[model samples]
Target: MGKKSKKGQSRGGNSQKKTGQKAGSGGNKKKSTAAAAAKAAKAAVAKNTPPPSPEKAPVVPEAVKEEAQNGAVAEPVPAVEPAEDSKPTADDSGLSEGVEASLVLFTESQQTLIKNLCSPPSNQAHLFDHWRKPSGVVSPSSEATNNVKRKFVAQLESMDASYPDGGLVGYISNAKTLLANSKSGVNPLEGWKPSVPTGQMFDKIDEEFEKVEKVGLNEVTSCGFVLVAGGLGERLGYGDIKIGLPTEMATETSYIQFYIETILAYQSKGDKKLPLCIMTSGDTNDRTVKLLKENNYFGMDEDQITIVQQGSGVPALEDNDAHIALDPHDRYKILSKPHGHGDIHALLYSKGVAKKWLGDGIKWMIFFQDTNGLAFHTLPLALGVSVKFDLAMNSIAVPRKAKQAIGGITRLENEKGEQRTINVEYNQLDPLLRSSGFPNGDVNDEKTGFSPFPGNINQLLFKLEPYSAALEKTKGIMPEFVNPKYKDAEKTVFKKPTRLECMMQDFPTVLEGEEAKKVGFTSIASDLCFSPVKNATKDGVALQKNGTHPGVAASGEADQYAAVRKIMQSIGCDITDAKPATYSGITIVPGPEIVLKPSFVSCPADYKVKFPNPSSIKISARSSLVINGSGVVIESLDLDGALVIDCEEGASGVISDLVVKNDGWKKVRDGSRDNEIIRMRGYHLD
Candidate 1:
């Protein structure tokens, strides 16, 4: 056993280094065969079904290694294709590197066996000549089941060091154990567990109906809004505030203007304009504020818009305080990458932002991404639903039609036996389980009878107090890190797969047992869910000038145009042909009175002309030049690509539509001795 352990570790190490090492390259073939038989026997015993004698174990075929290696570079094998009526298989082209190998290598036979076990009698393969259990564990008593549970726990703990980080086998096995023995009173479902049916996870429309009958919208005084504009806009290979990307509907509104307008829409649903805040990073602060003033704060009254810094931190594994260590270049390049947005909880609380909002009577905080303009900003339907369910955390779920996308919330057992909502990303689902058509498998435990939910949308609303408690608990418990796959662009062959340290689920961590029970989450299917704008063109594949319908328009909608469209639709305007003019910069007021005039001003448009609300403003041009003036207009320039505008208080300027190969270091030469805020914007061809 010791020898086999060392051999397994050595193989894993080698596999980690070689980009495409053949599985059969080394002469450890004999050892692996012996180990597989032994491990399979042990697993069978542990599962308490049957055990196989040495003679009955599958013969160690020398050709197996050759076949395994061939499989490495083999063309897609359709022989083992999932049964048509079994389960829907997600198109797995988007799977990250190493996940499949790490998962499949450890349990290939088990997966095959499980498939056979569940197969219809007609499709049954020859049964394995094996025994069910070496020992009996038939007792139904909690004590007896606990004894079995302990053995399983021990097995898991023992394998942690050998398996790759975030191995799915360990996760699944643990889940199974929790389900099996969870009938004991220790289960969370019977207590403060949030995923409990009556707790955090409530029926959406049903709950709202109750709330409407009770409290009513007029009595619902609390509102919350979260702004997630912290990521760098480098996906387009541009080094500027992606939030500042300019796109105009037929009305000519900018992205920033659009996002603010959406918030105002939410405010309009309630009594007053809600307290709004922006989560800014070091890379985007100066430009974010400049744009804020440029558009008259999106018609936000003074003191309503607040800016909070999302302070940087070190990665969980790095054991350092700084999350990003700059590169050698003076340009301040990114290092280990930003800690996942899960870290945002710590940022909000530690920075006192949460306390500030709570003191201001804000009971709920809606956390959403900035690039998703279509995020159902603040619909009465959603808010009312939230209040009715009394959900601690509520998310909006869209259909999971794409296999490449992350899996939504599903019920998973914590250390304590209660079922709770734990987010499983796309890669986390069992390939076999997902392929088996049980997207939401029989997650229920015979013991605890506690089953949570599946599929968690990124759009979340949490009550401030419970959220604060969860955030406090999360600090001591680092969530399991799922190392996803990404293209290693720096390698000689860019196609090679590399590990990305980010966790896409990005849900808050909870202490593995009953402590996690306090965090309940619910989901609802809503077409008004937010969609991300990632590219610059309107093929619905990239970012562009118009807004996307909830599921319509795959790409090209500027955030502003999208937000305006939502408001127009919310207020009963037929948005079918209400295209915001190109750069029709928007100014939002919760009231229905303010109307915006359409404009077709080009890039380098003046800040004042686009937004007449603020008497003063500043201007910063990312690429093309800007001229101060009454109304903004973009003059023809030698460069053209994408442009971002950064402006200051009490000032307006004109921008030009020019795509500069580079943001040239040109001198403004305007001799002015004023502490006026001079903002900067950038232009690039993405």
Candidate 2:
């Protein structure tokens, strides 16, 4: 049995040898079959997929490359360790190390953008440090947060970098520092005294009126009126432009219309066209431009007007110094706020408006706010004062009434022994010092007998050359003040955060030695020129009721409107005192819809000669009329409502004959009524 098993094993061994030789010989055939299968699969894939362009080739990761070389299947790659400085190297993201680091807080899409667009490096990361943990609470990392960070960083890096050597970055940094260290809470009455323009000085001003008038007229051609119309009418509960708010006039004229008409009237008195510069914030710029264009620039040449967009700032975070997010849900959009009036100088310089003014031979500039109806009324006189004194800057002030909550004009002797004119804000004054009979606290100049410092109306006349020089000298840096304001006025009961703002009138504080000496102050009647329309209900309604008295209705639109009417009536523009329309025992005098023609009166002295006996004309409270030009005859005309008469300069006509009687009303009437409401326009009697 052993011999048989050995033989069988030997036979099996011989069979195995023979099988191996056959397998070796046929190995090429098996390999060919495998190759054919692989080739077919490859061809199928090639037919279905398009070849990638060199520019759009896919980037294979390093891990995959190592796996391919080692003949092993690629495994999921582990996250690469960030560089020691937490910067991304070119090998990591194909972006500069700094840019990668700046984008660390950004999302994958943002990282891809940094990789592709090659954006410049910025200190945005540092700026965003405050936003990282708002209210000292770390928010979960999200796309929304990343997007917000990206936008804020972009804005910071993209600001106008054209400011001489300091650039926008330096300006922002310096401004932030100054605001952080500002003396806002200090008492201003420590070294304060009253200073005012005297009656003698006014007499002197009047004495030089003719010469000043001539000089002012000549200078008007070289002067640009800068209207700081940057504020939104939100505080007034108005969505439309504040300057476009209607004033009580026969034609329902707007403040802008009145302003333009006044400017045009002054322009008509001379051959030189006065240039008007409007400084508008982002919120108001477009609306202002549209309003002017729609009205054909109010008959003034478009070239005579220059509209400049002022810079805006973002609201700071409540808990941190970073900017506030526009949307809390997304936290991506940073909300922007209007920079204070102090931005005027920087805006003028940065926006090329100053350069344009200089090129146009504009030697002087008057910057005033738009809320005041009489803002530009005495600009000629103010310009005259500036020209007469050869002053670098002339500030127009009005006497501060007892307990008036307005800043007062003050003169301070600085450390350098230079007397600098400064505005003592009401908040900065001690309550005891602000009280009447406070010794040496009020601005009382004994020499001029002009006691108590006059309140500033923000009417400034700047000698363009020196003003430009001063702005350049300081790199257009202005002191910033922290103003507490609500983030959402409707929802939030508490103040959202403090806003940083600069006051344009604070220019004198930045000046030194000789520059301070160039600053001067002049006084004007507050009732005539300083009435500001601040609040909607308070201003519009109160002014309509109370007139221009100092204690009128907390200083609002109504007071300003009342002041304008009184000023007009004081002149010979006959505003007939018809009984105010009454409904439910409430006397309703027309608020903003009243309009008076500019040709009728430009000032208290320039009354239209056509209306020689203005008091002889009668008007009803329900009537809206425009009396243009001379030779108009009125014969007991009863105007119930809505009438316009365009009297030609030489054409003589009677109001009764000019009336276009409504035949339908006449036929329907009982004929017993002698008076009826009439709606007529451009009618002439034969």
Candidate 3:
């Protein structure tokens, strides 16, 4: 094992490479079984691969060198036939002395892999066409280039042996198609017609769904939850993993804690421990893991949690030619960005988490994004709708006005009669509508009072078996689109680098025809189901007047408080709706602040069982009530100040006609507050 480990550490076992040798003459032939898997395959490898300069010869081993050679040399997708024009010499530097300096860094088999990965028939060929040379080229150039020589050489040495060939090829193929479409002035939806889908509205979900929620409640044991928390909190002015930020000002619980506790709350009602899979990216993985370890998985059983880090980022492209982009400040590095949250699906599939869930009797997969604050509040009914309709996919939606920044779920039919139900990004929907016969484009519906197309919240649920099977067929790769901001009308240069991006919501874009019908949506009231802390404090304020949503920490905390207050008001409690107020220059949503545990009221019908209230519950202005236990009973309550009742899981508390008149935790504008949520809300305790 040690020998193999050392062998793996060396560059594809092509160590101690003594140079000054001629090409095409095999001075040292380190044979890879994969490159020489068969007569025809060896021919392919030899045709694409450059020869080695070492003295060793005829060194063919019996074991296939998959880790070193992969399928780069022997296989062909043949989207286009390999030709001389498709070779790396498209940059005219393939034969440069500097190229040879970079080439000998890898074993001959590894070189063969690199060549095939960038050459013709391989769709990534164009990426090498515009670069001064392929990624590893180290030629005599500018002073800056010389300074980064060692770094570039290291990049060449560490070339991925396990890079996903299929995904890279698909990406290049998509880019080429998009480039052509742009040049020809063709639209992706050229022959397609878009229409609004009357998805099942939970607001009006037949009174029969009270039974549906129960059925969903029963199915909780067979479900696994996924949290897509790959992003960082940089946009929110925090320096940690986004999930590590406090969700609300009251409990200061991290978003991950809220999710885990919510799952645990439902787990209590079921017989099994439902597994949780969190998808993180390179940016957040270490911090996220440390957070989980420090909190002991946030009360989750160690065995019940799985963290899957996202695959290596997709390469950013510089222009329509799809040349791989280099880091602007450091040319030695490839500029790679998150492949987008859509990678969560691919990660789950690649890690075999989805398959294991299925074998573990988990029949549903609930996928939600980070720090929404209302996903768990809305998940139960959505899951029920999935089970109720036997849907392969369910996108949680909220009422949307036309042209809102949020993507809208729409059903589309192509000229060929093939159909799909997917989220049409706001930018695309208006034009699609104009082209599809609506002259006004994206106007409100007279009957629905809003756009018939509901806004996509990016929270989705999938039936496990079909979901897993579909992913298996595609190897978990979603449809990817690249949007390059061309610096020219000819579309030859990019103003900035761009990469292919895919959305988790776009997962259903893969299903079509009758399979597409199996994909639908569930529209819930936005106030009750969607309050995401995604924007910065300032950006939220800009969108506050838009009536769509502010989507920041201030709005998120305020939304949490408002949600609970409405629940209380619905149950005959005189929960006063406070007028819109300001907290450190940001508009606080109008409502009383009421924060409670997930167990405080599982549903509106659940409060009666917990409190068994008789009458007289009034929470007035300048006051907030926070409840943190399922065992807490509230008979009659009147509060004019912050009244916090915190109880442990096994503990109980009873507050009868309790009243508080003193000053509560004031919303003092403390810029030095360590708590990010409170800091962003511009407040902290005295």
- Per-residue lDDT over 95-185 for candidate 3, one digit per residue giving the tens place of the 0 to 100 score: 3233333455456854554465556644344332322323333222222233344444344333342123354555656667766666567
TM-score between candidate 1 and the true structure: 0.44
Task: Give the count of colliding residue pairs in each prediction.
Answer: 76, 20, 0
Best by TM-score: 3
Flag the better candidate by lDDT, 1 or 2: 2
Native-structure RMSD, model 2: 26.4
Computed on alpha carbons, the lDDT of every model, listed in order, comes to 0.39, 0.52, 0.68
The Cα error of candidate 1 at residue 288, in Å, is 1.5
| Candidate number with greatest lDDT | 3
Q: How close is candidate 3 to the true structure, as a TM-score?
A: 0.79
Model 1 spans > 4 angstroms off = 1-221, 237-239, 268-273, 294-296, 311-334, 377-379, 402-404, 431-455, 473-508, 511-527, 536-686
Q: Please, what are the lDDT tens digits per residue for candidate 2 over residues 106-155?
A: 66754543343232221223222223222222222222233445665455
Regarding TM-score, does 1 or 2 come out ahead?
A: 2
